[model samples]
Target chain A: AQSVTQLDSQVPVFEEAPVELRCNYSSSVSVYLFWYVQYPNQGLQLLLKYLSGSTLVKGINGFEAEFNKSQTSFHLRKPSVHISDTAEYFCAVSSLGGYQKVTFGTGTKLQVIP
Target chain B: EAGVTQFPSHSVIEKGQTVTLRCDPISGHDNLYWYRRVMGKEIKFLLHFVKESKQDESGMPNNRFLAERTGGTYSTLKVQPAELEDSGVYFCASSQPGRREAFFGQGTRLTVV
Candidate 1:
């Protein structure tokens, strides 16, 4: 079984400021990591994922995440954020291979202010 | 392409009542999944369906919850004798068999009052 932990429950940042959302995981075997964003009253949309290969993975909307195997972390980062970036972000993990159940973190609410 | 969609975006029922939620996965998607998020909790997987066959159902809370996917296209989840703990958003997601990404639906918010 795999579990994901997103440390920050909420992060408030000024518009145009860089931000980092921390995520950590615990799994017995190799796993896949994912980041999803959800707007109010909407479903979650995939932002980025780390399946294999490179440690650094870039995703849509100028967001990126790095998979640090040693630390068991996959942290999402953005150089600069806009007010539109305000949303709830979640980190999830699933075991490698086939279709498996995904475990999600508690979620982090990003509030971008002007 | 049309994304995953769920019917009756919001449903309200009293405790001990019964409610059904529906989901339509993206066309041609072979893997469908059911997940839910209770108040102040993270989303949790309930089950998985590969076509009309259930691949995994370990996450199902109890027998009071029933899920069915007929003809391998759309799926339905039913909660009988719903409890106050069942109040939350139920989400449906789908992906290709080997695809790493799973597309999610808007979800059906079930409120047990």
Candidate 2:
């Protein structure tokens, strides 16, 4: 079984300030990590993923995440924020042993205040 | 390359009414999936299909939910006598074989009154 956790339900930050959205997962087997963003009324868009080699992955819209195996975490970060970056971010995990079903986190809504 | 597309972007029906959601996945992608998010909760897996075959449906909530993928093409999920608890955003995703990432649709917002 695989599960994902996003502790913050909502995060408010000032424009140009850095922000972080935390994510953690638990699984008995190897897994793949992903971060997706959904703007208002938009579909879920893939931000980045950590599959094999790199622990740190960069995504679109100036976002990035690091995969920490020992910590069982994949936290998303942005050095600076923009008003257009306000959206709901989801953390997901899928098993590496051909289990296609993905478990998602509750999501964190980022509100960028100007 | 077209992304996954879902029909009836929004629907509102009375309780006990039937509703069917449609999803057209990306071309040549044999893997399709269905998930739902209710009341701002986590997205829950519903089912998965591999070329007209029901690969896994362990996450289906109940028997009232019937999903069909005829001819390995588009898929439809029908809820007979939908209850208020079934109201949520239904998402459709598709990915190619051997790929881990899936592309999602805009989702169908179902409202049961």
Candidate 3:
């Protein structure tokens, strides 16, 4: 079984400030990592994914995440945030296989203030 | 292309009542999954369907929950004798073969009183 841990439950940042949401995972086998964001009253949208290759992956909305295999971490980062970036973020992990169930962390609520 | 969609954005029912939630995956997606978040817990997978067949159901909490995807098009999850612990957000997601990311629905918020 795979599990994900999001260290922070909530993070508050001023508009235009940089932010990083920490995530770590535990799994016996190789896994795939993903970051998803859910805006107010909206569905979960894929921020980015790390399937293989380049540890650093860029995503929409100027967000990016670095996959550190040794540290078992996939932290999401943004150089500058906007008020519209306020949302709930989730870190998920899935085993490397067909139709494997994805496991999500407790989630981190990002509040971007003006 | 249309994204995964769930019906009844919010449902409030009394304990011991039955509730049915529906999900319609994308047009060509063959893989459908059901997941839920109870209270402050993380979202957990309930089941997965490949077309009309149930590929996996290990995450289903109990026998009171039944899910069916007829003809591999749309899916329905029926919960009988709902309990307070069952109140949460139920999300539906879909993905096609060779796709790494699963598109998610807005989810249905269920409250049991």
lDDT score, candidate 2, position B13: 96
**Candidate 1 chain B, run of 10 with poorest lDDT:** B93-102
- Report the alpha-carbon TM-score of model 3 versus the true structure: 0.99
Tens digit of per-residue lDDT, candidate 3, span B1-107:
88999999999999999999999999989999999999788999999999999999999999999999999999999999899999999999999966778999999
Candidate 2 per-residue lDDT over residues B9-98, each given as its tens digit: 999999999999999999988999999999879999999999999999998999989999999999999999899999999999999998
| Models, CA RMSD each | 0.8, 0.6, 0.7
Q: What is the lDDT of residue B57 in candidate 3?
A: 97
RMSD of 3: 0.7
Question: What do the candidate models score in CA lDDT, each in turn?
Answer: 0.95, 0.96, 0.95
- The full ranking of all candidates by DockQ, starting with the best, is 2, 3, 1
Off by over 4 Å in 1: none
Residue B84's lDDT in candidate 1:
96
DockQ for all models, in order?
A: 0.81, 0.90, 0.86
lDDT of 2: 0.96
List where candidate 3 sits over 4 angstroms from the true fold.
Answer: none
